[model samples]
Target: MFFILLSLFIARVTAEAAAGGEESALLRLSDVPAAQAFIDSSEVTVIGFFETDESRGYKEFLAAVKQIESLSVAVCSEEEVWTKYNITSDTISIFRKADVHQKHLQLSETKKVDSDGLVRFFTINDIHYITEYNQASAVGLFQSEVKTHLLLMSNRDMSDFNQLKERLRALAPKYTGKMLFVLVNGNARVLEYFKLRSRDLPRIAIYDADSDRKWLMPKGEISAERVQNFCDSYLSGDLQKQNEAETSEDKTEL
Candidate 1:
């Protein structure tokens, strides 16, 4: 009897959720403070600033938000709130805390605002503080204004995987505009490209996409202080000088 009651409760909750989903999935914001709070509530959030539910591109924005279930999307029809975010007219904007980037899609300028285009826009700009490296995200990561990347390479199966990621995530904010923190997990192709082996389970490397240069951190325990120092040394030009010295030595030996 107890098990039957539990099943019924689950069914009822599911039914209610399904009913609620028929309405707008967007979290509605009525004022400036509420809009700011929603934007600050997540690492990434999309807010469609529309004058009304019938505004151009509003429906397509909702459909795109639904298609990308991972995204947090909201709606604001208040013109006063729009001024706070610099939304002059119907716009779909994405706010990313990672690099403090605010990307806007001005409906007036778009040739055609459709669900597919919105989805593509979101995917291309879905960069986070610690973005996991993958084909879909590669486009955004490479195109990011921050060309230097601090790569944390590891496999998910590693015992200390989550801890390692947390260490990087915590360090990411300090280097916000200077570097992008990327997590490369179990991508053997990437490992091979970097001349790394599985035995090198957890490692750190700095890759400058602009220069197409990579520097591997000397093998050691991965700690926050050590990683921070590594970044500092690179930014200070110490790493480049050291690399040049080493390269010169290699040529002399040859």
Candidate 2:
């Protein structure tokens, strides 16, 4: 009887060990403490979080997180976890330690990491401009004088909007492998000059081979220029630094 009991006990222990090994291979953000402990005991640690459909501005965030090789992720709702962490907005927060509170602080100023780290959102409204083109007129003269006068008379309404959009489209691919999201804050009456309705705005806009998802404001309030400035700042890499810290703890683990 004693010999039979010993054999059964050994079998159970082996099975438990194998299960534990599999569990250790995958890590989640909510399991931060265990993950940190693992990092302390192991050579490296990686964790991943999924952006949900409920998050208003996080459509592009999911793709950005997937680019990190160390992270293992899945599709799931972030509402409960985000509320627990007091994160009201759609964003990704990465850290080297287990303390969630400290990690939140570090994420506030995180920088874009190559093409994977670029995230953007916008709000545009109230763009009204008028212009006319004459096919019989000289192409160069018509462009220079006639177009210039119409734009000037419109009080900067149509000044450089198209040029800026083209420039952003050209640079989009260099920052993010995918196109960034463009949100219209409200007031699309300005687009009436082109006979475009708020809802009829391009669902997908392309520039220089890059394509971005576009959304229009249902109510229209902010100006298009303000929206452009906001986008420029988000893509400028001024707000945050990539993970470049070399702490003694990190070095010792290596």
Candidate 3:
């Protein structure tokens, strides 16, 4: 009789603990103060609200979020999060250090910068790292050099593909050794860009050598010049240093 009573008590305790765990796991956007406090204190916070079971896109987005360091992510209904943030649209919010929030806000209004320009930015969409099979056989050697890693497909058109390639090539020299480039997918705007632009080029893949991860660039008509300008304005300092180092090495060989 005593053992039966003890068993029931243990079961009750276990059930309560499980219930508490579930509650803690939930990120209640209604608790705005707590959410804001977490964002202010953490070095980086990533907030995403989307329907889980119905959103194939969100699943991939979550995978990318996992790759970032010191990033806090919460998945919930769009309506809930929008209500909490007092905004409309299902979007991702990234918060950096509290000290820089005001400055970042100011900069954000002036111009849209590159990834290196800010402490963090939304990827815009999921990345699709392509394999060799998706590449063009005619440019096999160049593909091999790039490792034929990831490809962006915004639409069925070929112009977008060319634009993406040109942009990546221009940007590659800038981030040669420092930061890795990320390609986003599933954006309607990006797809529309590709549909209206070039449509004959083969699909290409973007790779991250450090992590060995691949991301496909979204199909779009992004100008190579624009990409280059963006990189030059934001990443010129780092690229210049890398170029200098290479020049020094050549001189040593001489």
lDDT of 2 by residue, 4-118 (tens): 4454344334335443333222333333233333333321222233354444323444444444443332222335655554555444443222111122212334443232333
Off by over 4 Å in 3: 1-30, 51-53, 78-81, 98-254
lDDT of each: 0.84, 0.31, 0.40
137 in model 2: Cα distance from truth in Å? Answer: 57
Return the top candidate by lDDT: 1
True-vs-predicted CA distance for residue 174, candidate 3, Å: 33
For each candidate, what TM-score against the reference? 0.85, 0.22, 0.29
Per-residue alpha-carbon lDDT of model 1 for 89-142, expressed as tens digits? 888889988777898889999999899989999998898889999988898888
RMSD of each: 7.7, 23.6, 17.5
Cα lDDT, model 2, residue 242:
21
- Residue 116, candidate 1: Cα error in Å is 3.2
Residue pairs clashing in model 2 are 123-185, 124-185, 126-187, 127-190, 128-190, 186-220, 186-221, 187-220, 187-221
Greater lDDT among 2 and 3 belongs to 3
Clashing pairs in 1: none
Q: Which stretches of candidate 1 lie over 4 Å from their true place?
A: 1-24
